[model samples]
Target: MLYVFLSICCSVIVSVLLKLAKRYQIDVFQAITWNYSMAILLTWFFFKPTIPSLQNAPIHIYLGLGVLLPLLFMVMATSVRVAGIVRTDVAQRLSLFIPLLASFLIFGDSLNKLKVIGLIIGFAAILCSIPWQKKTANRKVYSNAWIFLLIVFFGIGIIDILFKQVALFKEVPYTTSLFLIYILAFVIALIVLIFRVATKKTKFSWPHIMFGWILGVANFGNILFYLKAHTSLSKSPSTVFSAMNIGVIALGTLVGLVVFNERLSILNKVGVALAVIAIVVITIS
Candidate 1:
């Protein structure tokens, strides 16, 4: 239970940190690049994943995630900044529906009644959670925020499915596979950073390194504590899953409303309520 609590805190804190990045003048791209460097170090120290032979490793999935993780991370940062934490977090949690949809449509799983209902509610939740506002002078700018939210919803969903593939590959320890994926992601991020710096798009900033390490710590802590929660409650995998999704949504809402002073419409609140209900229904079904 403590692990679950810590994991939830860490998850929400990541959003809060990203939310503060702009205020602190942190370079998000450089910070993200350094974030992977810190994550690699933490993955080694904590998980100590043994480097297995790469001959049978799932390199393709790793490469895909390597590309998507950093890219979507930037998208998520943008979403947090524009759409606010409440809507962004809800969208991320509800992304579970993507893999659930894949299971039914692509993997030939049965479309049971409960799952059908859950999916319907989940779809509604997404629509309601969108940060729809009245048409103002900057209506076009505000409307574009939803596009970032949509990208995060789909991007994270695809990343989740790829991670499921990594989990299915038993030839290597999951932690070891994670380490290699982090290395690949770091390399790609570094390449892009180098290019941007060379082209004078963005100069190097030391502040990004410090902020990135902090972000990495929170990011890695979220994973670590979540895994510990699962291990601690080995008999209740569903409990861990449900708690993680619901907890992040709930806590993130609190932070966004109280700490960040983010406003949501009545419909947005209803969507958040439905998102929680959908998680419970999906978990039980």
Candidate 2:
């Protein structure tokens, strides 16, 4: 329970840090790069995943997640800045729609009444979460913001799907696989950072350093405690997953509303509220 609580707190805090990073004009990519680097270090230190045991591990998935994670993270940063944390987080949480649909269509899993209702309301939540205010980001830009959110939604869903697949392979320890994935992410991010530096697209900034450290610690804490939550509630994976998603949505909405002063239409709040209910319905179903 404590692990779940910590995971939720750290998850929201990462978004809060990203919001603060924008306010401080910190480079998102740099911060994200450092984030993966430190997260890898922490994963390795605590898990101490053995390398030789990875001889038969799925290299493709590691590479795929490595490259995709950083790219999706970049999308998330843009979404957070333009769409506000509340809507961005909602989009992310709503991404469960993809996998839920996959369960019925691809995996032939039964969808119960609760899941059916959850699906209908989830659609409404996605629409309502989009920003309509012109000055918030302009209609045109908000339209593009939807693009970012969609990419984030689909990308994260894909990542989740891959992890679900990885669960079938009992050969490699998941912790080791996770560590390698972050290593790949770190490498890809470093290459991008080097290229951006060469083109003068971003410069070395001290705030990036400070913010990156903070983001790293928070990001790693989120993942660490999330895994812990599953261990602590090994019999109830659904509870862990549902609680984490709902906790992030609820807490993120509060942060955006109270701390960041994010303006949302009445419809937007309703969508967020519906999203919370939808997630619970789907998770339990």
Candidate 3:
């Protein structure tokens, strides 16, 4: 239970850190690169993972996650740019429903009535979080942002499914798999950086580099504790997922209101309220 709560706190910090990075004028790519680099180092120190035998391991499983990792970062960064922080985060998190549904259909995972209700309420909250354009005079800008949001939803939804698939692989130790995934992801990002260099588009700033590393370490900690909690608890993954998701949003909202003096419009406030209600229902059920 403590691990679960800590995961939520870590996640909230990630969002806040991203916002801070932006305030410091950190380029998104640089921020992410530094973040992942730091995360890789932190994960190494904390897990002290040994390389598992490649023999008898399904190579394709690792390969798939390796590919997914960099793509997830790209899409998530773009999503944050296209959508505001809060809305983008909400969409990305709630998009886990895609994988949840896939687990039911493909894996034949059971979903009880309570889980169903939770799913409904969770999605309802997501819908409410969507930023509605109110007679905006600029049609082109609105259209572009809306299209980006859709792309974000699709990208994040696919990423969630990929994570679930990786989690379901019982043959490999989850920790080992995660370690390898990060290492491979770092290599991929390096390759991408080379391309950026060739194109003369890469920009380096100390703030971005430093903050990225901090963000990465925090992210690694967040996932480590989350996986540990899941291993320790007997609760359903869906329930755990709901708790983490709602908790991050609730925490993010509070931080935005208190630290940033950001005000939620009526619709967003309602959405947050609905999300809280859904969390309660999911936890009790």
Candidate 4:
């Protein structure tokens, strides 16, 4: 449970850093690129993951997820910028359902009646936590944005499944898998950053680099502890799934409320409340 809570906290801190990036005039892409570099270096320093063992493991999963992480991140960025933050966030959070379902169907994880109820409530809580407002002005509809949102939703769920699959590998160290993916993602993000700068689309900034380091530490912690939680709760991936998602949404909501003074609508309040309930129920089970 310590691992679970620490992982959740790290996830929320990552979100907060990203949210604050705009206010500080930080280049988020650059920060993310540097973040990958920092994560890779830090992961090596602390975990010292054995690399050669990966040669015997499934290389495709590592490469597939390496490419998918940034692709999905870009999809999520487009979804948020075009659709609106609330919808994008809810869709992203609700993505746990994909892996949660896969847990039973693919991994043979089980759920009892209480667990099922908790999951249903957790889903509802995610929906409610995100506020929806009717557009006051009639604007052009871009169905493409909706498509991108679906891509992000399912795409992240697929990532979750991949991570779980990696955890199942008895031979490959989870940190080694993460280290490889981080290197791949860094290469991709570096290329993007360089191209964007060369095209005069973005300027290099020091603040972004600094924030990226901070983000890297937190992001690495998030993945490390999350993977550890899976190893800790090996028999109940579903519990960790539901708990992690709901806990992030619910606790992230509290941070936004108390720390940032963000206002939540009545529905959002109800959703946060239910999120708490879902976490409690799932934990007890």
Candidate 4 residue runs with Cα over 4 Å from true position: 134-141
Clash tally for model 1: 0
Estimate, for each residue in 155-216, the C-alpha lDDT of model 4 and write its tens digit. Answer: 98988888778877778888888899899988998888889999999978888888999999
**Residue pairs in clash, model 2:** none
Give the per-residue lDDT digits (tens) of candidate 1, residues 1-285: 688779889989987988799788888889889988998999999888998778888888989989998888778878867777657766786786776566446544565688667667766766676666733343233568899999998998787567656654668876787788889899999998999999998988888889999998998888667656655654444345445665576567768889989787898788779877776675566
lDDT of each residue in 171-200, candidate 2, tens digit only:
876677778887888899999899999999
Considering every candidate listed, which one attains the maximal lDDT?
4
What lDDT does each candidate get? 0.75, 0.73, 0.69, 0.85
The residue ranges of model 3 lying beyond 4 angstroms of the native Cα positions read 76-94, 133-139, 142-151, 229-235
Instruction: Give residue 177's error in model 3 in angstroms.
Output: 1.3
Query: Distance from true position, residue 250, model 1, in Å?
Result: 3.7
Estimate the TM-score of every prediction: 0.77, 0.77, 0.83, 0.94
The sequence of per-residue lDDT tens digits that candidate 3 reaches over residues 1-285 is 577779888988887887887787777666766666777777678777777787866567667767766766776666555555545655676666665666566655567888689768877776665555433343233335656566666766665555555566667776777788777777887788668868989766687688778888778878766766555543356665666766676667768889999777787677788778877787677
Task: Give the CA lDDT, 0 to 100, for residue 257 in model 3.
Answer: 82
Candidate 1 Cα outliers beyond 4 Å, as residue runs: 1-9, 74-97, 105-112, 134-136, 139-154, 223-247
TM-score of 4: 0.94
